[model samples]
Target: MKKFTVLELLSLELKEHNDLDLKCIAGRKGLARKIEVPNVNRPGLALSGFFESFAYNRIQIFGRGEHAYLKKLEKEKKSENIKKIFTFDIPCAIFTHNLMPTKDFLDAAEEAGCAVLQTSLPSANFTARILRVLNDIFAAREVVHGVLIEVFGIGVLLTGESGVGKSETALELIERGHRLVADDAVEIRCVGGNYLMGMGANKMLGHHMEIRGLGIINITHLFGVGSIRDEKRIELVVNLEIWDSNKQYDRLGAQKKTKEILGVRLPCVDIPIKPGRNIPILIETAAMNERLKQLGVHSSREFNEQVMRWLESENVRNIYFHNNSI
Candidate 1:
């Protein structure tokens, strides 16, 4: 079930009272009810008496002073304004600081269809705590259009415009034994110490990908159970673009690329796609290369070093031969 937040439950308007716990009591709200706050500590104020004036349809009481004062206000038969304000159609009243509603307050609440509850926490503290909890629980959930797949045990998130062949490339990767995490729309969240995790949306879960002219085909169904993944930790990002012949590409692999999500940095690679270039093979190679780096092996750098050493050795030999001939 979806989570509910405390901020989502609070009443629209609030009236401050002397009891600090009263703020905590304000946190208790229902979709159908209102809350009544009594000014027990400050009986001298005319505005304080106005609470008994509203419709007490649903009320809950907390705190002993509020309980006792409500009875006194009822016995004295407060003014019409006070009656209108206090006689609210409230559903529940929460008592803070372990204060219990008086018998008179209970009787009035019962007659008015109000419920009362008590709380031990200070009002301000409770409200603050509940607000934070609600913020996390009630945050909106939406689908982010992107492709996410697990490559070489590293979660890679691919982002680009529509019809960029993201799904097709992902399908190829799946066929090559890489796991498909999500297609079309991936829902990503930051969890476990700032690491981004991704999963398929409920509607798109376990669904096959669609490539232009290729029609719809399921990855797991076509490639067996080894092809699909339930979830994956996003560790890298790959952005695909239409190949430009005039643009210079990084042939030396010296350029370090990364992307930031939710304040966490992820390794990134930009692969330009065009005719005759196997994008899937390149992606696989990139993934494997990343694994090698993690395991302390750098193929490109090592190969470059080997070539440099060979050139140096040949230069030394040529100089010796020239000296001997001279």
Candidate 2:
């Protein structure tokens, strides 16, 4: 994984919860410093001159309480505590609620070559937002050639060799009211807890699909906002392959298949594509069947049980009839 520098983080043009609203106040030279940890440090304990277990590697955040303490330390000429914190190689310091640090504090930060940043948001809000952003940046990601869609509230990813009609199938699904998430390329991220989330790889062409003959078409523009989604949790994966006359396909569906992505297991099904096969409807049914499985209702298992009962009943009737006839 490449290192994420403070400069890249500061340059992100995010909005709302992902927005840091950060502006560099001082210590520009420390902008190139690498942010090793995703978690942050409040330093409220360190502000009172308690230096034990100081989280210097984590980004330092100064909220209302810390700001007031800095003022008190300045009035008492206790710059020693402030200087003591700068002794460690801290990544950067952020002041929330647009609060300005005292001259002594800034001087210490400047002398130590630590970056100082300011945001208009309050401490709590900025902390939560920044944590969310950092978690995403540090998340494990992979790119796969496929099309992701939301079918009946379930995220289904369709993958196969190039020109296997993956995009066309997704387009048909969209026409049937399903939502397209990503076409052509999908970026999957593992965000802890064995969860796999997927989204479009290209930001500009996320909702657009490139049909073999029709060029690129925007699904959102043609099908309205409901026809596309920003991202979805991949629940199922369907691999479409060319139909083979000699190869045998699973008919009972008793054997469950799974696809592993980023250490997360996803239900997988293989559908062979041939002439005159309704692939889109098959995918829709697959999605609905998966939803049933999630609810602890397995159609394949139930069918197998029913068949076993019938066979046992038939064998008992045949034995009794044969003995009576003899």
Candidate 3:
């Protein structure tokens, strides 16, 4: 089910004023209805204002208000007389705060085809809660642009310029048994805390291969089942860019990099693309190495330490040999 945002619900236009009037106006005065009361409410000036704003009529007011007082009010309105007040049609009513209505009010509302429901909250609080919930129910949804790929059991987002070879690298990764979530355009949504998901556009889902020479081809039909994945959790980002010989690249994997998307931070790596350079192999290696690092193995750092230890031992051995020879 699509969740509506709070803003959307509040923006809806009010149509009617009171249940009876609304029913008469909508030509549904004879139909049974259901209505809910969120709090123990009093049918007075403040309530009248709220009812007017809601534009919905709830005649069987059920709440903590006294039944005898309501019966008296009904008597004042003339036993069978309806005010011809305009309101939106409501079928049922509920009394909250365990407030029961006078027998006359209940009978009158039943004759008018309206049911009432009473909730446990106070009227003021209930009104606020209802308004808030409605607001979220009616907002517009939007999509974003990015790339989502499944690499090493993690959602790896690859983002860069138009021709950064993201697709090509992704294709290579797929061939290496990894999965592809989305290419070129990715739909990113914040599902919740520290989590953002990427999905493919319907038109482009499962359709693949836009390489310079090969226009476009379907991935599932061609590569079979392993080439595509429905979805994956995003764990890292590999941004591809043209290699700059003048610019220094990180030889050691110690410099931590991250890219922020939708206010969430994701680990990021900048891979330079150049002619004759195998980006596919590099990306594959990066994914595997990322998995290793997650498992507490830092290959580059460990290798560096090993080299330093070997050098230290070699120096000591040479000194001993020279001393013995002298």
Give the 10-residue window scoring lowest on summed lDDT in candidate 1: 35-44
Query: TM-score of each candidate?
Result: 0.54, 0.90, 0.54
In candidate 3, where is summed lDDT lowest over 10 consecutive residues? 18-27
lDDT of 2: 0.93
lDDT of each: 0.63, 0.93, 0.59
TM-score for candidate 1, please give it. Answer: 0.54
Off by over 4 Å in 3: 1-144, 202-206, 304-326
Instruction: Tell me the tens digit of each residue's lDDT in model 3 across 109-199.
Output: 5555444444555544555555444332322223545567787687788878887777777887787777777766776655434666677
Tens digits of per-residue lDDT for model 1 on 1-326?
Answer: 24222232443233343222323322233333432222112222322544443334323333445545655766776434333433655445666667654455555545554444555776555445434443333333445778889888978888777888899889878877888888888877655336777888765447578778978788778888888887787777888889888988888887777887766778888899888989888887887788888799988788889999999999999999999999
lDDT of 2 by residue, 236-285 (tens): 99999999889888898998899999888999999999999999999999
The superposed Cα distance between candidate 3 and the true structure at residue 217, in angstroms, equals: 1.6
Candidate topping TM-score: 2
